[model samples]
Target: MMTKHELRREYLDRRRALTDIEVQESSLQIANKVLELDIWSFSNYHVFLPIQKQKEINTQYLLHILQGKDKNIVVSKSNFEDISMSHYLLTDQTKLRINSHGIPEPDQNGIPIDEKNIDVVFVPLVIADRFGNRVGYGKGFYDRFLKKCRPDVIKIGLSMFEPLESKIDMHVNDVGLNYILYGEEVIDLG
Candidate 1:
């Protein structure tokens, strides 16, 4: 099995190889597949916006769906120093700006929302296994964030590619996912 570092590189390279149109189409397909999930009943939903430079799955399509459903959307601002993220309630009045790391996030003026209120999280990952273990940028951002949430919270990983067939070596602090949403596919680990 490949190490998380290697998996990150491989998946990131695959993402970088995607053309702009391919990215758009795949992201839309994944977003459409999300509708098939039974998770819409949840109220407060946390989502990660794409880091364009990293070729992450564009979450705009998913955001539109959340808006249509009138879900209380929550976004995060990262603190690199501690590899932690601060949650904020995303609203029409919330101002967003790209951080130095290329992540689009809300400004400090955004109203804070605690992790306990989140019922679902649309996780960002490079790849995941059918067992729901995911590999991200190795920063432990999502792992730490998910750990702060209620144990029953649904964690869904969004990817442009399908999950890896091999099991990933999970760290002690790693948080597993409940579902993985890829292009026109969903792996329900629950």
Candidate 2:
């Protein structure tokens, strides 16, 4: 099993190899693909955008404008400059954060939902397999969060590179992505 430190190193190295243009192009493509889905035709979908990194569309801008006109959107609480692999829900008023791990008591202000209400979710990952298994930042935040989400919730993995051959040590609780979007292509895991 690769140690957390080693995995971190490898992930960072691969992620850093991506150029600024590559990242932007990948993100734009992923955003475009998301907009094409018919699911957004009638229902209100909550989009969590990352804060901009070096003028790139970070979560904030992504959530703010990606849905285009006449769409419902919400932004999560800014814990830091970047949001990690966690899940948040949108309410009629605003977006609320949830504790993926039950260990830390969730904030009372967290928006409550029956998971089934969520239609789609976009998850970030350091690396992903062709099978859609993802490796996160060793926090298991997305894994735990997926457990509580509806099985039908479209889980899309966002990354800077194409699928790698490396095997990710996944626990039984680890969640698989339905699709993965990279700079040049989108792989449907379905």
Candidate RMSDs in order: 0.8, 6.1
lDDT of 2 by residue, 1-190 (tens): 6753576678767666767776676777666665544456434344544423322223433454444545544223322224333333444554343433312222446564444465666776777778888877666656665676677778878776667766666778779998887666778878
| Candidate 1 Cα deviation (angstroms), residue 103 | 0.5
The alpha-carbon lDDT assigned to residue 119 of candidate 2 equals: 62
| Superposition-based RMSD of candidate 1 using all C-alpha atoms, in angstroms | 0.8
List the candidate 2 regions with Cα displacement exceeding 4 Å: 1-5, 17-22, 36-38, 41-48, 51-66, 74-114
User: Considering summed lDDT, which 10 consecutive residues are worst modelled in model 1?
Assistant: 158-167
Task: Evaluate all candidate structures by whole-model CA lDDT and list the values in order.
Answer: 0.92, 0.58
lDDT of 1 by residue, 1-190 (tens): 7899999999899989999899899899999999999988889999999999888888999999999999999999999999999999999999999999999989999999999999999999998888899989988999999999999999999988888888999999999999999886798999
The worst-scoring run of ten residues by lDDT in candidate 2 lies at 97-106
lDDT of 2: 0.58
Q: How many clashes in each candidate? A: 0, 7
